[model samples]
Target: MVMRTLAASLLSIGVIVTSMQVSAANEPIQPIKPVKPENAELVELGKMLFFDPRLSKSGFISCNSCHNLSMGGTDNIKTSIGHKWQQGPINAPTVLNASMNLAQFWDGRAKDLKEQAGGPIANPGEMASTHDMAVKVIKSIPQYQAQFDKAFGSKEVDIDRVTTAIAAFEETLVTPDSRFDKWLEGDKDALTKEELEGYKLFKSSGCTKCHNGPVVGGNSFEKMGVYKPYKTDNPAVGRMEVTGKEDDRFVFKVPTLRNVELTYPYFHDGGAASLEEAVEIMGKLQVNREFNKEEIANIVAFLKTLTGKQPDFKLPILPPSNNSTPKPQPFE
Candidate 1:
């Protein structure tokens, strides 16, 4: 009689678990849309510029140097390696799915990808090249001029055109069709039991307040330490620099969870060496809760499901510099 009663209870539990899985299709997190470029030639031109190191004063660093497509669109370092090997102030954010971000940079300085693409090249600590120099170098190359004419209907090379092409290529970097996305699309077997539970906890534990939406986090800005203070040796004032407002201090754009499994070490300071540590730190500081080892593991498993199909394209072959091309000053 006791064995029969135990079997009945187990059967009842199974039904409840199945119901929960079905209901998960109604969750707010949306799937990423696959990219379809409107202008293939323009995108190809942008791809060439993205891979060309001639944009930098040293002719050694390209957009791919920091935001490597092979490594989840980030350099995967504590901070980026800059011109003269200078250390960057903050960790490099992933370029993948970046077009979905409300604003660019940790501080949300640039309004769009086009604006953001121009920043690093002119920054003294980064590529260390003036916009004029970059344009001059590109304009001097006859092959690039022909390609630009094909792309824009004009052979005039300028900073605006350069940045516009780069932005066009970056827009194609969106990733879609992750396991979590498959689950969201009503595939019951897409996520395991633990991942579903983790998703429930992720929403219930107040993580969804900031981490919701299509990209799972890039839509808003939040304080790094809402419940407590965040300690970091890296001295970034966050949005305060952009707004000149005291209240905006320590407030930063919440990074996207998409492909986060590959974009590490985590956080703006890149202090958390592993996803488990990052999750624990966020729970205590951002949500004012502590997660145990099992919970952390489950949450991380769910987070890993955010990894999707990365962009696939052939490596671009940059046009060679002509005799009139300005020389890059590596030391100056």
Candidate 2:
């Protein structure tokens, strides 16, 4: 009778262990959803505007110059080259899954993508175009006038409407259905054993504390180095510039880790050139733990699994500017 009782207990324990393992296999991060724009016409107009170089004062730079959709929604440069080859202060973050961020930009200064759109246009180092000039340039185009009318139900092409439409299109740039996402959806075999081990280590080592959620790390602001100071020549004081708070000096928005494999040259300073280096640096700075070479490789393997499906859309054909349209002043 004791032997039978022992066997039954062992069976019960096995069942319990299996149930827990199955539950843990499920993901905490949510999958990206297909975008359904309220105004498809507006999205179309925004797409044209997004690709049009005429929006810049120089007429040489467009939104796509830095945020190239063909290249992981980033220029893949350490820092962006702006108007007249002016170097930007920080690295250009990927625009993919940007709408998933709690706020836009590394500093989190802009509340949304719409507000973020207007900054570079006016920044002297960036597009170097005043809001009024951008509006005037767009207005000068007859085709743009018709598009504006169709999009907003009025021919009034203003910065607000322009940014609104741009933001609408940007909202559709979600990347979904990565291998990690597939594993998250309960496809047990979606990830390799090494990748699964890396994920377990990633969580066990406390990466998930900051990198959890749909976009996997854009939800909040954190200091660049929690355990040690991050050394960089970049003069940007991070969130301190935005909030003017002393404690917020090193604080910056946590970039999303989705497609991190593609958005290389990591961090605001773009210091870490490879995934392994970035992982090691992050582990050392954030958690005060130094990841070994094998550990770094495992983490990188897991990170590569985060690459999702890129947005698929035809290149937009921008409306032509008429003779009355103000010509771009690239040198001036």
Candidate 3:
């Protein structure tokens, strides 16, 4: 009887260990922690700059032009429209939760949000403005100068400080408390049966291999077509242009699935117009499997659960330019 009791206790301990392992395997993606900016003054200043088209050579295209907050942090177009209506090569990725990305841009070129902030301003096709000109425009505005002095403890308004303030504002662009986050927090009822099954299928089909993270992606760079080639007419060569490595061709930063439903026209080229089509294509190209209509729908449902609370803030009224301010060269 004593021997039998000891054996039973050992079996019970083994069962508990196995159960714990299964529970751990069920949760791979973590929840996002919403971060607020420590420097409220800097964030407010950045907000003005973000919405101020004066930063652009055309004095029309602002950071909000491509990354519209009302439209899920993207322009919702296949490609962005730039200065003089020059078409952008690749789709504009959403800025929501962008600070969580390993690197900025589809090619993972920019090291951080601050570095990424300067790219479009100088890109001839985008803002069509130089750093020196951008500083001059801001400095000329007396109201802006006062704000800069208060925010930075200096009246100086250089590109570095400008981008730093913008990055600070962007750092607070996180969307937390989604249904998926609730599920991750041990709320079993947060997700439906169908959604749960879809998540299981997603893991079993190896979709989570690349898309597993707090952001459900954006943690690393991955080839657009791992199992097969992705066809696109877009001329951008992905990471190859940055790394100059033949193997880096077609390797782009994996975008986050958070608020994906709102950021339609999927992929770098924005070839897949619908979420269903994007899921089907990803399954075929990345997993080498063709998902049925039901599977696709279920997966899309799971993806929708990633939508979180959007940022809430009042629109900033930009300071008007004075006589010293350089006139915008919209036509020039």
Candidate 4:
């Protein structure tokens, strides 16, 4: 993804994505850059919390349930079915590169990933449980209590530290290289001619305005109907739900285009089912240009090139132990 468009986000009117002058109807109205942390302990703690499903009301839905490392870090469901089979309105966003986001959630409601991680547990439509109750349940298990002691040096569990550990883990969930990244580093063979042409069109067509940066799009939020209204039978008001402003209505976070192919059911609302259809919709909604069949296909190919091998991050097993003996498996 391009960097400039992501700097300040696209929520503001007339936000430029870059300094370069282009003929696209909309151009760089913002700037962006890739960023990372220099810490260690928090990330370690976050990793533990990420895999511990005990935080959920059902004790079955870890962050991994929605953001698996093997599948672009996003659950494929159009909307995740949570506790008691409750359905959410939007598709799950990939946690693969969520650490880079300026605001969490499709509506930019949470200011950071740390803040976002703690939200669902008590959300009536999501995890639907209180921290006090959740901690009581997990601590009841001897294995969990021991693990918490080792990971956080405590005899008790709490929600704040739980989210801290998960956020730390999320910070490590980044994909740094792909065919596109290789091309950016000056490897001529990294991208195919068709992919290169698609890349050219991607930038020239004004997608870069809201879809650039290291995370590709997570860095900003924008009106979904800038060029055309996104057609829908069940419409969501998006950011306006949080901001309570008329203009913010239907404005959702611009997801990072990274790993676009593996993470399907696109957009904040998951309106267009396939990437091909999603691209076509973007053509009308954001770019105001109609994509020909070949153009759409080429764009899909280029987007596919954005995807790389699945990220390999094995979740650490729970219950840190002091014994030197080898751990036992379920078979034993």
TM-score for each candidate, following the candidate numbering = 0.92, 0.93, 0.92, 0.81
Among all windows of ten consecutive residues in candidate 4, which has the lowest summed lDDT? 24-33
- Model 4: how far residue 296 lies from native, Å: 1.1
Q: For residue 41, what is the lDDT in candidate 2?
A: 93
Q: Provide the RMSD of all predictions against the true structure, rounded to 1 decimal.
A: 5.1, 3.5, 3.6, 9.8
CA lDDT, every prediction?
0.91, 0.89, 0.90, 0.72
Distance (Å) between predicted and true CA of 245, model 4?
0.7
Judged by whole-model lDDT over C-alpha atoms, candidate 1 comes out at 0.91
Q: Total backbone clashes of model 1? A: 0
Tell me which residue pairs clash in candidate 2.
none
| lDDT by residue (tens digit), candidate 4, 1-332 | 45555644553443453333232223232222233545555565567667766666666677777776768888887888777677887889898777878799888899988799888776756666667765665556676666567666775667777776677668777776677766665456777888878877888999888887766687777988797677775567888989999989888888888888878888766666899899888998889999998888888888887775455645577664335322222121
Summarize candidate 3's per-residue lDDT along 1-103 as a digit string, tens digits.
9978876786777764443332423566778888967889999998899999999998999999999999999999999999999999999999999999999
Which runs of model 1 end up more than 4 angstroms from their true locations? 1-25
Segments in model 2 whose C-alpha atoms lie over 4 Å from true places: 1-26
**What TM-score does model 1 achieve against the real structure?**
0.92
Question: Using lDDT as the measure, which candidate wins?
Answer: 1
Ten contiguous residues with the weakest lDDT in model 2: 16-25
Clashing residue pairs for model 3: none
lDDT of 1 by residue, 1-332 (tens): 99788767867778645554554346768888898888888899999998988989999999999999999999999999999999999999999999999999999999999999999999989899989999999999999999899889999999998999999999999889999998887688999999988888898999989887888989998888999999999899898989999999999999999999999999999999899999999999999899999999999999999999997998888888878999988887
Position 63, candidate 2: lDDT: 87
